[model samples]
Target: MSNVSSRVSLSDWGLEPAVDYIERVQRSDGLVPWYPDGPADPWDHVESAMGLSVAGRDEAARRAYDWIADVQHDDGGLWATYGETDGDEGAHAGDEPRKETHRSAYVAVGVWHHYQCTGDRAFLEALWPTVRDALAFACARQAPTGEVHWAVGADGAVYEDALIAGCASIYKSLAAGAAIADVLGYGDARDRWLETRADLGEAIRSRPDRFDRTWESKSRYAMDWFYPVLCGVLTGEPARQRLEAGFDRYLEAGLGCRCVADEPWVTVAESCELVISLAAVGEAERAREIYEWLFQWTDDEGVFWTGYQFEDEEFWPGDRPTWTGGAAVLAADALSGLSPAGELFTERLYD
Candidate 1:
């Protein structure tokens, strides 16, 4: 409603170093490792790419998408995890050996984001097949009750339960995919994706029990708490109330949002995402307030740390994740309305 300013040029929101970190970790194939020798997850890789777009590195973003397309499996799935640059860039194993459904779907959001930033119709046209295939990989596993499953393995088996965080992200991917279809003149296909999006949103709001319930409950994770709002499946009064109910659960007044509700840790990324989520629900003042607090977590040189250990009053993980910087850039963009991709986190793309 307000379309307010977020005080950009004053700080660049530490994007310079964040961009540096993203570039440092990015392999020649455009695959950005979470850290050097780290397992590159698809969604985190895309977030880093989106950060590049926010910083006017459009070509980097496109190449990031290209790397995504290059490694995608024929079944429309990307590995839930990828090896380090020195190792096989396409090999899909990590600290664990399972695959995730959301990893494949996130490419849609990246493709649409690149299009929004560059207005590159040719780029969108080229990636349409990947978008179509990835969404199908995710959507085919949606339960009749409306929730999509969390991940699939290389063996081509489905994990029946859904993750609220993953599903919330997939919801955005679905909306973005439908929007992509609309741009490419796939009218019938777009309608189908729109229908699927609505059904999935209904499940997210009306059926939280449908997700990640059978396993250890993941409600402690802050992403599951705010993702629906951040992703636009929950908005307006519903979104505002959802955050209000959970404020005490994850928010730390002077630190940041917690990775887990009960943990006294504050992640720069989650804090940044909550800022966008607040703005999405018309809580712009609160959004800005949290955004201001986030700078406390950055380094002397500007790159943000992974998270702070508030209880110990120290840095917890001892790593400056590139995606953490990406989150800060995106949050600033959302608060300032600085770029086309700013609203990528704040506003709903589909009605």
Candidate 2:
């Protein structure tokens, strides 16, 4: 139940408090609300659930998965946001809104991960219908240009934007699903899906202009610099050079990497992501250092602040994010050689 990795030490870091905080959030129905005092969103819940599973809370993790499954729409998609509720009516009714493709795909990633950890074939089989339909829905929204649309409103309209975050997520989900299909013995389908994922990666690399010119801008947001590289869409010398430039430009001494050029705050998500990016490029020592730095943001309860502002005064607002913890677990898993999904893509077939 402890994260006793030989390569990293947690002795003086107050890890137990952070672990307790993660447990608290898990017990509170796997929802790490963004604002620390706001309503729970599905996105954070999915991420938090994965964190719980990583921390060895199998029962709680399964409950979190059940929570997501219980809220799925009739069309097999999940809402972008939701309140504390247990039924489809709660998720589907009210003025609460939902987005397609991105949110749905994200939830599927968590579910897929849970299945991988548990080897729960029946659980996966039960969700396979929903996962398949969700994949189809996401694929339907993919433009001929290979960019997946960001969202579909509850009104059934498309919100078309090449959000780098969403695009990165879709790539990961598709890759995960393709691997699952292969394991489930859908070899032909797996190859087809893998091919689609490859094409999408190529599109992302070849046509960065199509997504958002701002992402390609020299302004330097941590995500803009790191995500494409993390997703394996950016590779070899180009990715290495880009990450190095980001390090030189935006990294600070005590505060870690800034989300943007002018920002003095260090976001946990971005910082953790930077660790993964560093490892991806074979900078294991630096990556481990960054990972250790991430622990400083953890509170007495294992909850990490989204970020810390350092200019006028210091503050780490809100509850720890599921994405923050998820990123941590993912980075650790990658470093420890335990990510089954990562194993499936050993050769970067997409490139």
Candidate 3:
């Protein structure tokens, strides 16, 4: 399949301001919060770090990873959320919370992406141990049915239910983990992760009964509908078909993608993810069209808003998140090939 390339460059989007926003919100200890005085989550923090890599803020990106490495628990997990920074320093880890598998596993994706952007083998080697432990932490949660349990509570109670969207993300993280292991010459680790990933893909494709067993169906969410494709579990014609089936239900015409099927709201993050997913299955024109729709939603500082509530015809939530802008930057990179890791979302890690 041909890689997608945008007609416009990253310069055309004028995302320097968005990069500026991420830097401005980054704490002294390297945690990237949702916004100033907002909480930080590991997954979104990693996403923002990827944006820093794409925007030539390599040092900032490295600092972000270092912080992630520092905070990982001995069991190789991290709390789902961290309190906001206290005066430029990171928050204390006194607040114990549940750890989500996908959130803990995402470091592999960020570490691999940073390597792709920089080709810095020394850096990759330095972070290899952290990636190894993180994937180990996540894969240990996989059940015999091949679905991973979503989280474990602070009191050691496991949340046995699985989420399609979260598992699909873990599928991709496993692929990235395997790739990193291969590069570092850990053949045993690489093979193990590959085996786990294949089983997870099977669960995603053929084992619908395994997910959301204890809760209501999550079919209304756009992520659950398209994430398998975004994460490379679905490809070629099958991937394209899955996206087409949900187009009417999730896409908001020229605006963006709706976060949920029944909501009249459009989110920049989901829309940007959709762009990458569309491009993954060779829908270049369609991806570019959706990409154009997001340009009008940026603030005066170029930071994209959280989402727009179309019923009210206004940008709701009144918050601009660093991760949302990060998603936009990632979407542009996927289309424009502006960075070495531009195809990170478009290509499967292995055949």
For each of the candidates, the C-alpha root-mean-square deviation to the true structure, in angstroms, is 2.2, 4.4, 2.7
In candidate 1, what are the lDDT values of residues 1-351, reduced to their tens digit?
Answer: 325653453255556887877887888889888877677788999999988887778878888999988988888988776774334544443433445778889999988987887899999999999999999988898899999988775466777899998988989999999999999999988898888888899999899779777799999999988998999988788888999999988988888799998888999999989988998888888888888887888788788889999879898799888888888878878877556667777768876
Model 3 gets an lDDT of 0.89
lDDT, ranked from best to worst = 3, 1, 2
Span of ten consecutive residues with least summed lDDT in model 1: 89-98
Query: Between candidates 1 and 3, which one is better according to lDDT?
Result: 3
- Stretches of candidate 2 off by over 4 Å are 1-16, 27-32, 35-37, 84-96, 213-220, 337-351
RMSD over all Cα atoms, model 1: 2.2
Q: Would you list the C-alpha lDDT of every candidate in the order shown?
A: 0.83, 0.65, 0.89
lDDT of 3 by residue, 1-351 (tens): 335444555677788888889999999999999999789899999999999999879999999999989999888888788884333233335544688999989999999999999999998999998999989888989999899999887677888989999999999999999989888899999999999999999999999999989999999999998999999999989999999999989998989999999999999999999999998998988998998999888888778999999999899888999999899899889888878899898988885
* Residue pairs in collision within model 2: 17-300, 17-301, 17-302, 18-301, 18-302, 21-301
Q: What is the TM-score of each candidate against the true structure?
A: 0.94, 0.83, 0.95
Deviation in Å, model 1, residue 89 alpha carbon: 6.7
**Model 3 CA RMSD to the hidden true structure, in angstroms:** 2.7
Q: Pick the candidate with the highest lDDT.
A: 3
